[model samples]
Target: MAEPEDKTRRAPLDAVGRFTATEAVAAALSLIWLVAVAAYSFTAPDGTGPLGIVMTLMMVFLPIALIWVTVTTLRSVQELRAEATRLQSAVESMRNAYVTTQVQPSVQRKLEEIERTAKQAETALATFTSRRDASLVVASADRKAAMAAPARAAPAEDQPALALGTPAEDLRAPLSVGDFIRALQFPESPEDKDGFRALRLALEDRAVAKLIRAAQDVLTLLSQEGIFMDDLKPERARPELWRSFAQGERGRGISGLGGIRDRSSLALTAGRMREDPIFRDAAHHFLRTFDRTFAEFEKTATDAELVDLADTRTARAFMLFGRVAGVFD
Candidate 1:
């Protein structure tokens, strides 16, 4: 079945046939007039008054006959022009329909696949994160028990009591695999009670603040790179960063509200992008980068490094972990 847009722009096939018929009739009449004129000139008997008179009379009426033929020809031309206008309008409408609707099905399918893969990746990362967190808790308990053990009563200065373990520093350490997965599963939002306020307080700590900034920067970079590839014109991509920032300022607008509204725009944009060779190439590049960054994060972050993470390097390491888990939020 034709889409509504297609139906709106579709021209009847008989329009062309009608236009051709009009042209053919005009041509045939012109040819017949030419043949009659030629035949009369050759077949008329010399010096025969009746024949000469008849031929003369025919010649006299020729202008009127030509006038009628001219009118018919003009009418055919007008009809042909109207038909051509209709066809052109239909063609333009079809072009719009093709760009807006027909080109999007494949892109929509691919986006759905990406969403599925992202969900699976998030699930796997969540599992790994839970296990890592459990391990940390167990390890901390063991350390506490060892430290709490009694020492033998002995003369002063004979031997020093075993040093007790201090609380593991930086309890809210940089995100681990599990933390990253959690963030992806439940993205941080101001909508959650005290979520934004708590985040701000966390940022007061130099370590957490730096890590948060790094994560934001990484997302910005990825978004910029994607825009760069899609929009070859520097001016077009230049404003993209501002668009992202504006989305944050506006508090998610349509997408942040969590509804189908965002999907409609996304689908439309994806369809347009798919039709653009430059955008498609850029999208593939961005996808590859996403995959590579994930691999690096999964391989490089260790439990020990996650515990005492303090510097920008550690923050970047955590950001990488989050990226791999597809929890850029």
Candidate 2:
């Protein structure tokens, strides 16, 4: 079915279209000569002059030449159509062979790996969540008991009272990135596989997505001017110190955003991304793709480990952006 369609699309110009200019002229000449011969044959009384002989010869052979030309042309056209069909079939076969031997297997392997990773993450998340819930329950009960009991004497000056567990927020304190520079100092984490899955679940929350994007936008803007995360030194990682540079603070041996050649400030770059339609659309697309990679992580209950992943991933983004931007030497 497809082969005939391909041949039709690839049909030769001379095979199917109107006759060429030379062919048209020849056909027209033949027709005019035949008409002239017929008129002369009817009017002439005797076949004795040169005109009679010429007319007689033309009338006899002209029809034979026209018939021979038509037959030859029809055969030539049939040959071109057959050749086009064969070429089309060969191309289709080669394309199918390439897809079967190369593209299909590679795509199949990637799909299988993604499926396997998702299952592992799901199982890990469930186990982590159950343990966290049990801890929270125990912590709650102890808190209730302490509150209902009478007040006790204050501890000695050097001693501090210890509880079974600390508050949930305190446990998750490591994820906070109030100072972007401080968050990126460390790159080594053996638990990165576990952490990655935990963070994937955390990104399901819109707030986490917004934070990561903010850091990514900052890095992307800096990269445009050839300035990079790695250009930033460790000292520049502190939130207060970095803000000093961003705010164009003096007394650092440099002027307002002096290191950058574009004369564009970080504040301005950030504002541009925030206001521009193109950038907003790009940010939305990034989050959508990022969310898809860890879609299954969000289905289970929340675990402290998952929350930690969110924190770690956010801080990691800042650290990575800074390093890539050369913010830390």
Candidate 3:
């Protein structure tokens, strides 16, 4: 009875195996049919049987149709891949930008705070230095006074006090045309090409001679009007102007014509005169002369004459003034 039961189980197992094997064989045969159809359609020549001709035509038509479907499938897959890559890159870029934007403001604020603190410190240092210098001057004055008292007592009979000499005239005068030309010849850099050209043209123009004469006349008139009262008074002339003049002079060593060689220098000088009470009165006198001179010159001058004037020495001087005033530089 047990043997019969075992035989029943074995029979069912055998049937299941047979069914699986049959299905596998059928699937393989279907694949072989598809392959054979494809190969036969492609390899078959023309002018054969009607069935063979039909198969050949089908082969041609079928491949074209299949190619489109294959290409579409491949293109879809490529598009999906590209889209995925773009999305990933965009997400990464956005994350980086967000991080940078969030961090930058705090850094900028700290930098600003540091700069403000540095400026405050500089101001405090300058103030302290000024006060210290003033104290030193006061102490020196006291020492001189104490020494003068003893000298005065002995000066009547035994020792004669030395007479003080007048202040020495500056040996180095204001820049001359020759000096300006020389400076242009040896400019500090290639950037001075335009300036060199302008200067050269002005030097060649006879109108520049007239312009210089006019400028000198203007200067004389200003002096006569007492606008230059402080030209004789060292105390009245601000140290700043002298310093600027000195710097301009020094710049001549490198470029020959310093910042003071331009039109802005003339304007600055005029502005300074305006600020001074005595100079302002003198400037008014010169202003009238300037207006009259300029009007006459303009009225008499044609465009050609004006161009000639621009090409002269006076124009070069004007250009120099402009450069000094920071307009050109």
Candidate 4:
């Protein structure tokens, strides 16, 4: 086929190889002409005999050899130009990659420096605010003392016994912020102590106990849904993370929850509390109890052995879940 012939075609490396091939062709032609001339001279002793024949053949073959050389030279030039273009493109690509590599670290360092500066500014602001708050507290105490001194001295002997704020008479009664504030005040006398005892007794009522049981049921439900109390703690310190978890984007804030496993269970449990009648009533009761109790509860009671009842993990969960469900609204 023509393909095999094309592959096997002679290609000269340089002008020297072309010249050598041309000379070889000329030498072969000259030898043939001499042989022809010798035979003709013997036949006719004066011979212009083969001279015309040799010149005609030379004219015909020389041009063919020149044309072959010109074509090969043009093909080689095209191949060289193609290789150069490819090399230029590769070099451009490498330059872009090198620039990206060189710039990344400096950009990253600049970003880190900005973050550090922002943190330092936040720390300074926090310190200044704390100092300002402390000074204001001291000044307010001084103002109160100055205003109350005369009135306090005259009424010290005649003042009636102070009373402690107790739980409301009705379990479902809505409590006000002012009622809670008054309840959180320190017990100052035997009468106040008696009031706190009565309040504590009232908190043990069956209806209030049902609220605690309801909170426990919620905890159990979450357990079945594959969420746990320990899992909620780390989130407690982070408001946004906790918010995400409560919003049904459970896996968004917890990396472990991102796995496909437990995904379906979480989906099934997401709004079940709101949908189920039993859980809905329990949630309502728990929220009502929590709101009224939290209002009347003393913040300092968390550390007190007798009144540390509301400081448990279960109680904390109720408060957190109540907030997320808009129960305290």
In candidate 3, what are the lDDT values of residues 105-214, reduced to their tens digit? 99999998996686556545533443223332332211221111112234567666666752232222222333333322233347877555534543443433343345
Instruction: Record all residue pairs in model 4 with backbone atoms less than 3 Å apart, i.e. clashing.
Output: none
Q: In terms of TM-score, how similar is model 3 to the real structure? A: 0.26
Per-prediction TM-score: 0.33, 0.30, 0.26, 0.30
Kindly list the per-residue Cα lDDT of model 1 for residues 68-168, writing each as its tens digit. 67767666676677677778777887999989897699899999899668655654554355324333333331122211122545748866665565334
Give a tens-digit lDDT track for model 4, residues 1-329.
45563211223233335545545665676566667755765686452568966865565556556665765676577556656666776788899999999999999999989966865565455334432233323322112211111123343666665565533443333322222222222133567864354334333444344444566567666676576544442111222222233344432243321222233443444476657877566656665665444433322111121122322444455544554454333
lDDT of each: 0.42, 0.45, 0.42, 0.45
TM-score of 1: 0.33
**Candidate 2, residues 90-117: lDDT per residue as tens digits?**
9999999987888888999999899668
**Least lDDT summed over 10 consecutive residues: which range in candidate 3?**
141-150
| Model 4 error, position 243 (Å) | 16
Candidate 1 Cα outliers beyond 4 Å, as residue runs: 1-59, 63-89, 92-113, 118-187, 194-329
Task: Return the number of clashes found in candidate 3.
Answer: 11
